[model samples]
Target: MEDVLELYEQPYDPQQPVVCFDERPCQLIGDVRTPLPIKLGSARRVDYEYERHGMGNVFGYFDGLAQFCGRN
Candidate 1:
């Protein structure tokens, strides 16, 4: 839309900060077995099995001009 584009074209103002916010549901997972430690020539190995502990939300806020961010 023209209005949206115009908003983006405006110069940044610290006094009137513009913040963008977003959130999403995240799955909390954990490995079922202990992973093997890495050796001199070998890499660590982890099992494919995982347990879902619970669900949670991840939030993010950002201001492009001010280079500020907040998360939870």
Candidate 2:
């Protein structure tokens, strides 16, 4: 929307700071098999299959004016 875009376009001000916050539900996953170690010029190889261990909540906070971020 125009209102959201206009808010983002405003210059950063320390006193009147702009902050954004978001959260996500993350699925904890694990490999079915032990991954192959990395070799020269090659990266570690993972299996095509995975196992779901549990769920987790991820939160993010950002201050546009101070260019600061925090995560949990």
Candidate 3:
């Protein structure tokens, strides 16, 4: 909405800092076994096998006042 966008246009206010939050559901996966380490003349390798651990959530936070946001 226009109101949300307007918040970012205003000058930073430490007293009334604006913060946003979001989260994404994720499936957690893990390796079944230890990976093979690389040797002097050999290439490192990983097994094709994997195991599902459980469900999780990835969260994100943004600070409009500090102009600080992080994501890939």
Candidate 4:
């Protein structure tokens, strides 16, 4: 794990930018019921219920150099 963590310390190299990637399985969900419309003086309200559509994979990547100097 230390070896992986150390990759973050690498200096930014425009010619060879260090990159990190990860993927997470996520649930796709939506409101089971339509939200109640908001009125003049009331806050819009949504139902607490949700419906799962299916499973999804989310992928993300980061440029080590982009955050080397806290630029990102």
Q: List TM-score per model, in order.
A: 0.67, 0.54, 0.67, 0.66
Which lDDT values do the candidates have, in the order given? Answer: 0.78, 0.81, 0.82, 0.83
lDDT by residue (1-72, candidate 3, tens digit) is: 999898878877677878888999999999999998889988889999999999999999877558654321
Give candidate 2's error at residue 1 in angstroms. Answer: 2.4
The TM-score obtained by model 2 is: 0.54
Clashing pairs in 3: none
lDDT of 3: 0.82
Q: How much is the lDDT of residue 30 in candidate 4?
A: 98
Tell me the deviation in Å of residue 34 in model 3. Answer: 2.4
**lDDT at residue 13 of model 4 (Cα atoms):** 67
Please write out the lDDT profile of model 4 over residues 1-72, one tens digit for every residue. 999778766666666778778999999999989999999999999988999899999999988677766766
Which ten residues in a row are the worst by lDDT in model 2?
63-72
lDDT of candidate 1 at residue 24, scale 0 to 100 = 100
* Candidate 3 accuracy as TM-score: 0.67
- Clash count for each candidate, listed in order shown: 0, 0, 0, 0
Clashing pairs in 2: none
